[model samples]
Target chain A: MALFTEAFLTALLAGAISAGIPLLLVGLGEQMSEKSGVLNIGIEGMMLAGAYTGFLIAWKTESMGLGFLAGAGGGMFVALFMAVLCVRLGLNQIVIGISLTLGAEGATAILHYFQFSRTYPRLPATLKWDIPFLHDIPVVGPALFGREPIVYFALFLVSVFAYLYRRTHFGLALQAAGDKPAALDSSGVDVLKVRAVAVLTTGALAGLGGAFMAIVGAGIFVPFMTHGNGFIGIVLAMLARGRPLWVLGGATLFGACLSLTTALQVAGIDIPTDVIQMLPFAAVMVVLIVLGSKANLPVSLGTAYARGER
Target chain B: MTSEMAIAPDSGENERKSRLNMRDDRLHFLIITIGPVLATLVIASFILMAMGVSPLDYYGYIFQRGMLSPSGVQATLTRMGPLLLIAASLIVCFRAGIWNLGGDAQFILGAVFVAAAGPELVAILPVWLMLLLCLSIGAAAGAVWSLVPAFLRAYQGINEIITTMMMTFLGGSLANVLVKLVFLDPETTVPQTRTLAVSDRLPRLFDTTVSSGVLLGLAAVLIVHFTMNRTAFGLRLRIVGANAKAAVHAGLPVATLTVIVFSLSAGLAGLAGAVAVLGQTGNVRADWNPAYTLTIVPLVFLARFNGFATIAFVFLFSVLSIGSESAARRLGVPNYFTLVTMATLLILMAVAEMIDQRRRKRKEV
Candidate 1:
């Protein structure tokens, strides 16, 4: 009711960003993958893998940084496996992606069962960073300035990706490969090599996002911890029309919806919690419906490459 | 001087000659039957070993407990009720080249509808009539839930895989909240529905835990198999699945077929849920995490979308599940070991297919 209360709005925005960070990382990664012509539907599985690996490593080693790296590494390895199937084996990409997602989920569950017997301790790993100058700049600054390191990392990556995608040759080539692989091939670039790297990079970022969820957000590894974060990322990437910078906007909106639902529940809304929980997914569905109608994606985004076509 | 140019046998001639005799008996067996049975055994063994139990002892114990004893047989049948039905439901869609991963949700919706309707219907109707209503409502609920992804794919072009999966999540959470808030039995320590009257429950077969659902599931399998192989609609479904563009060119209503097949598949899942409620659980509960929905993928994969293969795969998975529990109790191993085996076998099956594809490529070259 108190819209003018700077403190109340600040706290709300802060919490929204906290929730948004995971989606932001995932969205950025998926954007890169989609831009390069691979729809990494296995993003959720990769996130789950990251969550398990991050939790297991952090709990065992008591090193947050190492756990994060382990998560990224785990995601990269799985993404590379997917790359092998899609890029080298020429299986149906959609089926391969779905299979990879299932595989990651199955593998994570199995490995975690064997490694820790699903009994690892929850270790608090995320560090809260407070900027000296920014923290002193009144209500807004204090609210946003003091948060987890991941928030900053997510924001930084958004800027980096926006630049790389719009201004760099590598970005142009990657985008071109998605829209017209033949052109990229004719230009003497190895499309497979570029796409493989793009897919791996996407996995690493998604893994990092998932690691942030486990090590920072939850402080423990619960089963299915990723909880469709990767899918939300896909929705965000799609909603953004595969534009890297726009992914941040999409992630923020989705994140806000999630945070608002949770907040509304806490605020004792009369609606069922199930209804509230469906808001993010509903939002994504709506966004996809709108964006899919308007946006024209790359023609060859989901198609397989023929040998030496150029 | 040493020899004239030697004439080589024409490969094209060999191809033409082999065309009529193109039956690869071994490959056919691998595809149709052996693959599923082998995958099941491999997964079952992994699960047993991981539980620190010897597979031999576990299998022996399962056979003794689950197959030999009357009570054990009832237990196995009870477990098979939902799984068989779910697998059968999957067969209908998968054979038509559509994958329905929302079975978990559909199943829960059926349960929810049964819980919501059972008491009200009991006041006005006979037990059999009430049961029929519950089953039909359940199927309707499932069909409604399925319409989202079906419509999206049919018209808007959203990926059904993700959409269907998202619905599963939504359905699960919705079921949980309903169980917690609406149908909860206040006296019970955990959230669940009030137990229904015995007359309203599914009829037990010869005073055992096994209900009539097993027969119903088998009937479903037969019906679905016949529909796919013998019917005009089934033919269109197969063509559309194989190539939508070609099917459209051939004057088939691809969109209508897509929606109908999806609805049929989801309705089957819903029926599975009703069976679980009336026949197995005898009441609804929040423990709606039916792992079979996800596990069904591997089962269907092993079966290659064949109805009989689906039954065989389900039976195989059931044995493994039951055997794993026996191993855990006897050998002090964890039950999740079974899942590990199932996953490993699934990956292996995919890899095997990939290898087969490569072999074909080499043969062509």
Candidate 2:
């Protein structure tokens, strides 16, 4: 009759990881874009596009890998506009980003209406890859080590991003573009090119994250299923302050809180569901505000770079 | 001696060229402003074609239903109340160079505050007085909700966009909680606040179905426009917005202006919410978001911060929104098609602005 039974604890842990993976992917991607001086407000749109395409592809081909690829492609497709308009053409990033998200939402919803409205097909449970020794460990073992390959891949991306930021020339270039575009331009590096590449990569990673949400996290795609995850990712990236590890930590905390909400609901807690559901958002914002206040964003963030113009 | 003689003729030629440039500037401005709208319509037509709907027919139906019909016009007029207020809110923040994306949150909170307080106040006071109290409470709530982001941006240099949006998500959840648990009407099976009697609601305008809230919306827009353009306070806010560091050096109250802008913007959004409830809906429902904030954003931007222009655009937008529902159902298309069109218009506008900037830079070179 205990509320904290072993089975319940394990489910909560598993749910946390499932929720955390998409956020991690999005945070990492957003961090890269921010590093290169692009805020990427349209990432939500990219995520939605990825979710739709990823789900559609997975549903049709019955292959998760192909679905993830298609999702990334769809995200990049939306990002192409971001690169051209915000980065190349020097448009206002916020306005363009908002429009892109709205456009993507409408486009995907219409696509869904035509293709899947009647059937509303859902994907099967994703295949998990169990790590040999890790899978046998108590409560945490099955939850962390027995997730789908995408979960591990998402975890691995944290390390990959950390390495790229700390030890790579490309990372240095990205940092320079965000901090001092004029200096970077003077040094013969193409600021526009750097920003364009960063934005596109952000799109790809965000798309992959969206795909993971559709295929592994939810086992289905719904219109606007990304549901502000992209915005949460922005907050994570900002709070992380260029630290990939912090992004991982923040994402994990957020995901765990989400799982806790679900647990509370399932346990028949006598509270309004809306209040219970608000825990994750409130928790994340409070934590970030308290802990990440000193974190510094890029100086040149959200400003268009015009050569020789102050 | 020869160089001096040459300079005199070149100076005269430059004078003529400058006058020509002045004449061309007006034409360039017109192209930059209007070209994007035409482009968006053309692109949206392609999307309509892809959806197997006739663009002309859809647009025709929208015009017929939204503007030509009496009921549709009334509906459109009623819808404009929230949009115009939100547009006024946006004008304040954007003119101050502050991005207060929390209008949606402020709006929902405002509505919730009115829903919870209006019925109780109605019992104690006359209907008009009760309505005034509800509106003030809603505006106060919205302003309170916005204070955190405003303070953060003004003092800590935090970006308001992320903070405001986060607040929006939280506000939405809180609104639902208020509707379902805190202020649920026992009489109704549905999770909604206690509805006000029809007699207690805002009086209809000219005996038409349209609510008098439209007049309030127009008044708010006019006041905002005047505050942003004609007054010395407006000039000071503009100076602060133009360059905060410069304003500080000039001893202008940059921080105070920032907070004031946010309060005014959020207060207007709250007023919009109050108007929607008292003038039309009469109550709040769980998980219901009019989403008036996002819908009005493009209209505000398209108007270029001009109050009269905003009224025209809001009129057009409300017509599209109200008229498109029937057309969407008939064509088997989603009502979101209008969103697609509006979003496209916004993008095209950004692109046009970019192009205009590029051309101007090229001319300077």
Candidate 3:
């Protein structure tokens, strides 16, 4: 009985770590973007685009690290396009973001089709980190220490981001840009540059999240496989209320919810599987409801700043 | 004073002559009617030519193979039916300046609800009555589904775009659940709802393949267009949409209008679902790919807010979709190239608008 219980706990922990990494990366990345007053709702599409690009690059070059960089670069491309629309053109941010999501989705699918036109190539498999001596441990090693280095990197990023946002000059400028771009502008910070860099970096990190899943988790690129994780990141960002530290908590909670849903299905509970699958979304809804009740968006969030206007 | 009055009358005469001259400009009127079609043709031809095919032949083949043939027209009309209905619904909300990105979710919920409700209602009522009940049920479900984001936007001030979009994805999952758990068809190879009863289906329009659903969609469009363009409520919505603060200053009920417009838009989207189940698919199936909600947005926007233009755009898109599939099979081209083409066209259109706005600014300067 103890053996079975330990095995179950090990699987649950493994699932949480695996699932949480992507959310953590995406949420933290999006938090940085939003903190600079740009909402990249296209993150999901960008993730999918990155997944394909990473998979294709890895498939061709047979290099895992190159694939990861390609993924981040692919995401950056889309983010730069969004910056052009939102910052340069002064389009409605939400519409432009959504439109770019649609555009990216269509473009990514086309890219996938063209890449696999001559031959079917599988995603580059992720390498597991076999920690010295830790690999000898029974369940804990496999559950915690056996993940790819990328997973550790993602978790570390969460804390690093939390620290940066909490205590850094650049982070302060980003926050100032989001809440009061005018103040930042007056302070001689190029608000547009700050916002642009923030959005671009968000894309790169989100792309990394996609590469983690496509290369490591599933080892294949599937259409719409990010499966609303990008939106979930948005919800996470909202729940965090732009606090990087809170984002860690929010992402872990979401990841736990996702892991629980999977575990429940495996446990063969009497509850409907769809109802369980819906838990993450339900959690997000609850967060949004609370966030909405609290009215917590930065006062100037989701708006493009026009210079010399009032 | 008498000489100045004489000159004023002459000036008025010149103004009237200029107005009459504008009406006489037939060439300008022709451009307005023929410009979009020409643009579409030119783009389509250029694309076909670039692919090393004769554009004229391809156009002819499409017309002869799809539209001129009975099945072609029937298919076109069949596709047109739901599209027109959905586009009209989209138009209503857009006109009110509310972006309901939740159309897809509303659509899926409507399908799920009708799928669940159709068979039971058929046993209780006659065929036509059952269809009506299913549609009403579907519309109600959509409205209920849409209320979440709409209410959030109105009361809590959440951004409707994300909330609506999130709801759409959730609704899709809910549809999957319905198919997998509630109405899982045991006989099908894939997860899908049970086939609805034949009696519950919409009547065929002709002895041909076309269904009465096409007429119904057209009727809905006409009714909605009238409601939007010719009604006081619609005018109030337009005012509210254009400037909410100004609308309030003008004593228009902006809040009430928002709720009404969103509900109506969602209800219309639900009707689209009902039509799909009753007229086209004859059952709710999870096998349906692509998010219909996202699909409808481009269709509506690409219409540039004209109801008449929406009808044409839907027809054009349906043809492109079917034609692209045929091209994939016959020409060995990637079928999704159609979506790529459509996306490119959309981005181009937006760019064109941006350029136009800039030119206007330059002229003003």
Winning model by DockQ? 2
lDDT of each: 0.74, 0.85, 0.73
* Per-residue lDDT of model 2, residues A1-310, tens digit only: 7768777778788888888888999999999999999989899999999999999999999999999999999999999999999898877677788899899999998899888775668899888899999999998899989888888888888999899999998899999999889999999999999999999999999999999999888888788789889999998898788999999998888788778766655565556667866887787567646654644878778887878786
Q: What is the lDDT of candidate 1?
A: 0.74
Per-residue error for B207 in candidate 2, Å, reads 2.5
lDDT by residue (tens digit), candidate 1, A196-268? 8888998899898888888887798776778778877876786677676778877777677666654554554
| Regions of candidate 1 where Cα sits further than 4 Å from its true position | A2-11, A34-41, A91-120, A137-140, A167-169, A172-191, A261-272, A286-310, B1-28, B31-74, B94-100, B185-189, B206-208, B360-365
Looking at candidate 2 chain A, the ten consecutive residues that score lowest on lDDT are A286-295
User: Could you give the candidate ranking by TM-score, starting with the highest?
Assistant: 2, 1, 3
| Candidate 1 structure quality by residue, lDDT tens digits, B1-365 | 00000111125676575575467834564673556446756676776576566777766776777677777677777778788888878877766667577898999988888877887788899999998999899889889999988887778766665578778877888888888888887879878887777767888887676888887887887778777767886766777666667778999887888899889999989988888888877678775566467677656655556677677667766766776677667765556556555555555566666676567668868
How large a fraction of the reference contact set does each model reproduce? 0.20, 0.52, 0.21
TM-score of chain B of each: 0.83, 0.87, 0.84
Sorted by lDDT (best first), the order is 2, 1, 3
Error of 1 at A205 (Å): 1.9
Q: What TM-score, computed on C-alpha atoms, does each candidate reach? A: 0.84, 0.93, 0.84
RMSD of each: 7.1, 6.0, 7.3
> Candidate 1, after superposition: displacement of residue A257 in Å?
3.4
- Quick one: best lDDT, which candidate? 2
